[model samples]
Target chain A: MKIGYLGPKGTFSEEAVIKYTQGVENCEVVEFNTIPEVINCISNSLCEEAVIPIENSIEGSVNIAVDMLINDANGIMIKGEVIIPISHCLISDAPVEFKDVHCILSHQQAIAQCREYISKKFPNAEIKATDSTAQAVLGVKSKPGVVAIGPERAAVIYGMRIIDRDIQDVKENYTRFLVLSQKDGVVTGKDKTSIVFSVPNVPGSLYNALGVLANKKINMTKIESRPSRKKLGEYVFWVDIEGHREDEIVKSVLEELKGRTDFLKVLGSYPKFK
Target chain B: MKIGYLGPKGTFSEEAVIKYTQGVENCEVVEFNTIPEVINCISNSLCEEAVIPIENSIEGSVNIAVDMLINDANGIMIKGEVIIPISHCLISDAPVEFKDVHCILSHQQAIAQCREYISKKFPNAEIKATDSTAQAVLGVKSKPGVVAIGPERAAVIYGMRIIDRDIQDVKENYTRFLVLSQKDGVVTGKDKTSIVFSVPNVPGSLYNALGVLANKKINMTKIESRPSRKKLGEYVFWVDIEGHREDEIVKSVLEELKGRTDFLKVLGSYPKFK
Candidate 1:
């Protein structure tokens, strides 16, 4: 099996793929520069599956991934999910002291996660944003007085030293990555079905659509609103409910939602990550 | 009156401040580097009011601004809102052709917005991410073969020329900005109230909470979920209802919501921008 992930081999997405397919043998992992590319690869059959971060504990939704999964990758389905605890390390090529470092580099999200620590410790350092934390690690490999905040795996992958460990402001940071494949998972006793739907732009329309789930006593785990990408003030709701799509109640709720909503798409039914 | 906005002078936030306070004399506009800083300036009385981008047509919500308004800046209230049409321009110091540009710089959001345009026009250019589009304009001022994607105002402010105009991929891109003041706005008859609340982590908790508003026939304009920042799977919902908080129906809805949620914070009631 071939698994594609957003990577330069040291991203949290790569780490997620590793942990998710830990026991699987003969797995070939490929790296893509962006989330959309990973999804594109999945759709193009360049890879059998793709792993992408769906949500962060601090940052609500990974909009690019969610939007792509909803709009671009039509046939791909989420098969599983992995939760990885995020721990950012300040890495450098040389034995540089904290005060001597003149520049810091990382992805925008990583920089945001470590905002407070960076501002306090390296107020004078020039912050450079990169495409990915792993890319930052690669960029800073031969540069002195420059550090990259990335996963510890990045430091190892790029042959750099960790100048500081666990520098993120929030200690409880965790990212949820979804495993996407051409096939959706079969009904697991404990499963979650993810769907995206848009209600007509009328008063009480969203409430009426959500009532379909509430009326059937179905429990929704998450609900998020994203721009429908068609126009301003237009939105589509992404929801996760605690049941397989094959379940009778879940099927009925989806059928009722289909009738009520302007548009509805079932992304997938996957085993719940405990 | 002093108005604060996210700035290096050329951000959409600055434009929002200008449009939102149009025709007002003796208004001093101050610029802050980050959204939180702008909010802090308002809370600390450094500025009488602050304008920050709340949402985008393409991007769902400005999480930093929303999070700060919900968690950090107490006693601050939203006073008004302004909608700005975002038109990104490819700017440069010299009159260079698109083919001559070797590097492109912009804020990540701007880069994402103009992804198709940039990739199609300058496929080989190195993409650099900056803190803000204005900052990108500043960074490219002395560099040849480098261009920044920013508001057209930035080109005038920085003495740069627009190499390409309206380079954003989406023609309908618009950003919604909110004005924050120490004092809340009075009922404007046609008003909107924004509130942030966290429902208990139980099945049907959110459904029941929304039931309070639906039962009263109150129309909600927007609903967004942000991480509570305490732990994973915990979120606080931001809802914009179509009425002033002082309205009888709105008041009853809040009272009922307060009883059903674990945490509730009314951001403010303000005149809804049409």
Candidate 2:
């Protein structure tokens, strides 16, 4: 199967795809610039499946990920999810100390993440914002007085040296990405099913729909609502429950869910991100 | 009041602040590059309140916005929300036809939004990525063969001429922002209250919490869950209800909610973004 990712190479998403498809065989990779483009390619038969970000600083695009999947012309499903810890390093073509660096390069967010470190160490260094952190790592060859902030994997991919590690202020940084495919993943026994549904504009209506899971003692992982956009004061709720769509209880709940709301779209059943 | 925004000027966040504070009195706007820093400023007394993007291509930093708010030391609240329609215009120092363009500049996402237009009309034009669309507009000083894609307000702010309008692939483009302040907004007759709470590791714990709202006949607008991040297999649920916290029914719901959950944090009550 061919796997697609958001990339120009040496990105964290590439690492995520690698980590996810580690044991899977016969995988070819395709890259797309935007989330909608990457997911749209799925329904158009450009590739069998792909990995896209739902939340993460690397992508920092949660809403579009959810919005596109909701509005995509073709049906897309979540197959799996991976949470990649964001570890930014000061990567350089050669080892250098903070004083030796005259310029710094990275994506705007990356630079901002290490803003305190940069201002203290390289107070006069020039800061250049690239299209992506990987772009900064790729462009690090020509500047002797420059260091790029990006994933340590980027340094290895570009054959660069790591000047420092974990330069970002937030040590608990992480990005969660979803594996997208034409159909949801097979029952992993431990899976999460995501669904979108709307209800009448009255009290207890949503509570009634949620009762299906509550009745069966299912653990709900997430529930979010976005404007319906078609009309004023209307909303559509997206939910994540702790069971695959194919699971016995989940299947029965979905069937019952159909009758409880205006419409129900079972987005996908995927393995939870560990 | 002093308001904070993500900026270097001529960006969408600036426009959001302007649009949101249109009828308000005595507002000063301060600019910050990062969401955490901007929100942190509120606690530090750098600014009274701020507008930050929750969703939009211009400020594709939704995760940071949500994450920062959930953990902000200052106990920030959502005072209001505004949805800005994204309308990109091709602007330059002087008007230039598609044929006359030698290069196009904008934030990568803005350029991608107009991807099909460029691929069809200016296939050979050099697509340069800048720190932001505003930076692209600012740098258009000598590049007569260049045009930048950004909000039409950029053209007005930068004194540039717009050569083309609405060249993006999607027409229903909109960015949602939240009005953030130290205290929750006033008791507007029509309001939304947002809260974050957790329940014990029991089957119907979450459902029972919902019962409080249902029993009060509150219309819930949004519900989202995020990892409490403090432990494994634990989550914190963020919810939005249709009535102000001060409202009788909603107040009763919160009082009952306190007894039914692990902990509850009333993020804030704010005027609904209409």
Candidate 3:
């Protein structure tokens, strides 16, 4: 099996793929620079599977990933999922004190996750956003007065020293990563189905559509609205419900929802990460 | 009067403030590096008002701004809004051909907006993400082989040349920014009220909460779900509905909604951006 994930390496996405595969023999892992590229690789058959972060406890949905999975990647399905506990560390090139750091670099999401710490500790340090946390660590490796906030594994991979550990504002932060493939997973009793739909422009359109789930007594785990990309104020809602699509109740609810929505697309069914 | 916005000067946020203020005399416009800082300035009374992007046609919600407006900035309200049409340009230090560009620097959102253009024009160019589009333009000003994707104004502000114009994938892209103040706006007759709420963990909880709006014939302009920051499966829904909070119809709907929801917060009411 071949897997693709967002990386320069040492990223949570890479860690997710590794954790999902669990050191499977003969499994080859490839790295892409962006979330779309990872999905694109799977769409183009460059890789058989891909792992991408879909949501964070603190940051909510990864819009780029969700957007691409819905609009760009054709015939892609969520085969599995992994929830990785996230711990951000401040890593630098040397054993440097906090006062000596003049700049901090990381991905925007990582920077946001650690905002409270950065604001209080390095009030004057310049915050530079990079493409990925791993890229930030790579950039700090040759700079003495700069530090990067990323996974602790990044410091080991880049030969940098960990100046501080668990720097995220909320200590209970975790990212949910979805394993994508060309086909949907087979019926697993413990599974979750993800779907995207847009209701008609009517007063009770959303209420009617969601009523299908409420009527069937289906438990909705997540619901997010993203711009349909056509115009302002237009949105497509992504919903995660508890149960496999193969279940009779789930099938009937989706059937009713399809009729009420302007458009609907089932992204996939996958085993819920525990 | 004073206004704060996310800035290094040539960013869309700065443009938003300029467009919103529109030549108000003696108004001091201050710049903050991040969205939280911009909101923090308003919370700390460093600026009497602030402007921050709330949504994009392509990227959906600006999560940081939404999060702060909901959780951090106490007693702040949306006084007004500005809609800015976004068009990205390729900027470089010197007049350079597309083939000569080895690296492309931009904010992640800008890069994503122009993905189709960059991939077709500079297939092999390395893409670097920066904190802001203005910062990317600044980074490219001293580097000959690098280019940036940002507002056309950034090129002129940073003494750079525009290599290409209107490089965005979608020409219809626009960003909606909110003008925040300590007090909510008075009834403008044509207004929108934004609120965030969490329904109880039950099957029909969301349906019942949204029922408050549908029952009263209130039109919801937008609905987004963000992680409550408390748990993975939990979420807080942000809803934008027509009418000011002071309106009798809206007041009743909110009162009914408050009773149905576990927690609710009214961010503010403001005139609809024309």
Candidate 4:
């Protein structure tokens, strides 16, 4: 199997790909610069599968990923899911004292996850957002008195010294990634169905549509609304429910939802991330 | 009156301030570097009020603005809303044609909004993300063959030439900004009350809580779920309804919601944007 992931090689997404493919026979991984590229590789026949980050506990949904799936489903579907525990580290090119640090560099999301730590530990440090955390560690070689926040893997790969470990604001931070392929997985009995639905922006339209799930006593794991891109206040919702599309109850629920909602698309069914 | 805005001047937030404060006398508008700074100014008493962009038709909610408002209310309330039509322009330091542009610069959100245009016009141009759209325009001076996407106001203020006008992919783009102060606006016949509520991640918790609005026949203008920062799937939802908090139906709905939700915070009611 071949897998594509967002990378400079040392990102958490790379770690996700590694963790998900552990012990799998004959697995090869490719690194792409952006989530869209990582996802598009599957559709473009450049790769058979891809892993992309969908949501982070602290930062919330990765809007670009969700937006792409919502705006254009285009034969892509979720085959599985992975939950990676996020542990951000403070790394520098050389051993340095905390007070000596003058600039903090990392991807914007990594920087956001460590805001409180940054403000308290290095009150005077200037922040520079880089394209990726791995790039930050790599760039710090030429930039003195600069530290990067990212996975410890980046520090190891770049020959940088670890200044601090587990420095994220929320120690329990996690990111949920989706494994995308041309087709979804078969019913495993324990599965999740992700769907995108649209309703009018009127008062109870959403409430009415969600009733299809609530009435059947189906459990909804996640629900998020994105702009329909047509107008302000108009939205298309991405929802995850606790059942496979092949299940009888899930099938009828989707059928009922089609009538209640203006539009509905089933992204896929996948096993729960354990 | 003194007001704070996210600026180096020449941002859409600055334009929103100008438009909202039009016809007012003796208004001193100050520019801050970030959204947090703009919001913090109100609590620090550095400014009487601040104008900040809340949502855009293309980019959806400005997450930083929404997250700050959600995490900490701190006596700040929505005073009013202004809907500014967005029209991104291709700007250059010196007169340059489309083919001469070697790099594209702008804030991530602006770049995202104009992605289609950028990819089509400058397919090979390297993209650089700046702190703000205004900063992108300012930085273009020393960098040869670089262009920026931002409001025309930035081009005018920075003495840059407009290479192309209304270059955004979507022609009907708009951004909704909020006017924030210590207190919310007085009841207007056409008003919007923003409130946030939390429910357990378990099935039907959200469905039951939203029942309060549906039962009262209150029109909900917007609804979005943000991660609770505690766990994946757990969420706190921000909702906007069609009536002022002072209205009897709205008040009753809010009271019922408090009993039904794990946590509820009324973010205050304000006049709806025209």
Candidate 5:
């Protein structure tokens, strides 16, 4: 399978794609700068599959990913899942003792992830936000005594030294990535299915829609709402339930759900990773 | 009131802070690099209030804002609210047609907001993501034919000319900003309250908690769940209900909610903006 994902290289998305495509024959990675571009690349047959981060432990939801799936719900299905632990590194050119640095540069998310360490260790240093951790390293490549916090790969790619590592506030910080493809994904014995549905604009609508899953004892792992773009005051709910669509209960639940919701799209079902 | 917010200059946070402090006396805007810094600045008496963008219409929730509020529950309160319409502008060093651009640079959120326009208009151009839309302009400052999509003020600060205006996919795109301060905010007759609560690890816990508001006929504008750092298989909910905490029904609901939840934090209650 040829996999496409968001990157120029050295991004968390690239790492997820790599792990998801492990052991597949003739697996190649295609990188796009934007999430929609990655999805488009697959839709347009530039690649067979795409991997994108849907949520982080610290960041609630990746809205762009949600919007893209909702916007292009026609030919895609969730094929697999991967949750990677996030650990941020501080990279720089010259080794200045962490105290002498004046500005700390990294992605806004990285800046948020490491705020506690940055404030406590270097209270006076100005936090300079960058587009990406890799870009931040590039910005301070020529400057001495400045640090960029990002993935370890970015330091190697940008030829910056890791002055400090594991700076994120939460040690168990993980990002959940979804692998999407043009056709229905292969059903592994152990799997989870994700679907997006929108009920009619009335009271008890959502409750009735969720009732299908409840009747089957299908535990929902995640539930989120995104404004349905076509209309105001209407929303589509993205749901992850603990069963594959191929399962007997799941198939029945989906049938019931489809009847009740105005719009229902089965995004994908993939085996959950450990 | 002396106001501190996140900005170098020309950031959305600056605009929101200005809007919130419009009619206030002695409102001085002090810029900070990060949200935690804004909180710290306010906590240390450096500023009377700090404004931060807590949520965007396009992006679901600003998790950093929620996490910070939860972490500093006792030290801050929601003093005021401002809804600023987010309008993205295409900026470049030299005026040029959108089709001729080789690269389009912007902050991730800006890229997300202008997804439809960029995909439809400049399908072949490379989308380069930057830390801030301001930094994106700075990236292409010396390079011609490189354009950026960001706020108009960013173009002004970077000395870039506006190639196009109001390019966001939705005309009603707005970001909700919250004013945080040590003192309890002045409550206007018409107000809104925000709170965070974690339910008992039981099936009906969430339903019962939400029932308090539903029974009181209080409308909920927003509800989001964030993983609690304390334990595995647990989550905390951030809710924005449409009434002041001091209202009789709201107070009664809070009292009932306190008895049912594992823990509850009344982040703050402040006057809602139109």
Candidate 6:
């Protein structure tokens, strides 16, 4: 399998790509700059599969990944999912006491993930933003008085020593990554389907639309709304329902929903990843 | 008004706090470690108000901000929102060419946001994550061959020159900050209400609950689902509807919903920020 993911290396995205392809031999890892790029690569047939972090247990949803699927309704399905546990580390090249470090560098999400520890230990150090924790480690390695907060694996890859480990504010910080492909690789009859839709800017519209799913006794796993850029008083909704598109009930629900909204698209239908 | 937010200074959270509290005189900015801490500070009378980023245009949503409101439902209400445009810059201590830099640092979101730009311009540099962009700037400020991607303000504050500016991959990147207060801040009469609820695990339960709101002609601005921890199969939902709790229609909708769901709580009823 040729797998593409968001990475230069040592990123959570890279780790997820590895985990998802663990059973496959002769796997080719193609790194991209963003989730969308990976999706595009898969959509364009550049790679057989792509991995994107859909949501972090702590950070919620990654809209870009969802939006990419919504915008491109060309048969891409989520073949699998991987829940990767997150562990942030404080890394630096200097061996001086941690108190001597005057700045903490990391990605904003990492900062948020490790907020509690940083606040208690380095209350006064200037907090700096960087593109990634791996990059921050490089900055620290090249500097004399800086510390970087990232994953332990990132520290190892960047040749930096871990000054502190497991520093995330929450112990259960895990990211859910989706493995997408242009074609469905395998099917478990009991699968899930994702769809995006927009209804009229009037009351009762969404209720009427959701009625289709309710009437058919289908289970909805998730639903969220984002502002529609086309008009000010409009919104686009993303929904995850627990049934395959090929199912009789799901087909009926989609048929009924077609009449209730101005636009609707089934993002994908694939077997649920355990 | 005295203000509190999540910050150590120079974080996007601090930027959001400053943006949302625009033009308010004698506003003291207090920094806290967590979203709950910010709300607690406001609730305990340590700060008159608090501002936190509730969502991003690119990132979809801020889950912590949402969870904080559910837990601290009685004490705080979202008063207003700030849509701040985000721009990334590569800051370095020495005016070295972009190719001369061996590593780049930024917040994880920053890395995600500027994915394309970094891959195209400095594809070989190891990207590191940091706590915040400001910290990344500080790292690059002492390192001659490293670059940090952050807001332009950080470059100015840390005396690092910009090797490149406006490097974000997305042109429409924006973070939505919410202004929250213990009181409703004189309800504008026209307001929206937010609520969290848990329904029975049976199929069509959410649809039935939403049907009441639809039947009452109430429009939902947003809806999202998160796992409710107490039960294995149960789920909790967060919803935003276009009406005040005092409104007759919304009141009736809540009455109908209460009859169906096992648990429900009104998060707030503040005038919607335009």
Give the number of the best model, judged by DockQ: 1
Candidate 4 i-RMS? 2.0
Please state the CAPRI-style docking class of candidate 5: incorrect
Candidates 2 and 6 compared: the better one by TM-score is 2
What is the per-residue lDDT of model 2 for residues A1-274, given as tens digits with 9 covering 90 to 100? 8888876588777888988988888999998754566777788888898887675442233555677776665778888888777888988897677778987878655665676677678866756655567778987896788888998888888899998888776566677778888888888888999899998877788888888889998887666665565533456777788988888889999999898999789889988876
Q: Any runs in candidate 3 off by more than 4 Å, and if so which?
A: A7-9, A23-26, A123-131, B22-28, B102-108, B116-132, B135-139
DockQ of each: 0.63, 0.31, 0.57, 0.60, 0.21, 0.29
State the lDDT of candidate 4 residue by residue for A1-274, as single tens digits: 7899988889999899999998898998988876778889988978888999899998888877888888774799999999999999999987888888998888767877887798689866766656568877886896668888999999999888887999988899999999999999899999999999999657888999988899999999999988888898899999999999999999999999999898899999999988
For candidate 6, give the lDDT of residue A95. 75
Where does model 6 exceed 4 Å of error?
A8-11, A73-75, A91-97, A101-109, A124-164, A229-234, B1-41, B50-64, B79-179, B185-188, B200-202, B224-236, B259-263
Docking class of 4: medium
Off by over 4 Å in 5: A6-18, A21-34, A92-112, A115-150, A153-160, A186-189, A198-216, A227-235, A255-262, B6-34, B91-112, B115-161, B183-190, B200-205, B229-234
Q: Per-residue alpha-carbon lDDT of model 2 for B1-274, expressed as tens digits? A: 8999877698887888889999999998998865556777778888989887765542232555666676666677888888888878888897566788987777655665676687678766656655556777776866788888887877888788888888876666677778888888889899999888889877778788998999877887666565565433356767779989999888888999999999898888988887
lDDT of 4 by residue, B17-65 (tens): 9999999999999998777889889888999989988888887888778
Among these predicted structures, which one has the highest TM-score? 1
The stretch of ten residues in a row with the least summed lDDT in candidate 6 chain B is B226-235
Error of 1 at A95 (Å): 2.1
Cα RMSD of all models vs. native, in order, equals 1.7, 4.7, 2.6, 2.3, 4.7, 5.4
Interface RMSD of each: 1.8, 5.6, 2.0, 2.0, 4.6, 4.7
TM-score (chain B) of candidate 4: 0.95
lDDT of residue B131 for candidate 1: 63
lDDT of 3 by residue, B125-161 (tens): 7676666789889988678789999988888888888
| Better DockQ candidate (3, 5) | 3
DockQ measured for candidate 4 = 0.60
For model 3, what is the error of residue B147's alpha carbon versus the real structure, in angstroms, after optimal superposition? 3.1
Question: Scored by CA lDDT, what does every candidate get?
Answer: 0.86, 0.76, 0.87, 0.87, 0.76, 0.74
Better of 3 and 6 by TM-score: 3
| Cα distance off (Å), candidate 4, residue A218 | 0.7
Ranking of all candidate structures by their lDDT, best first: 3, 4, 1, 2, 5, 6
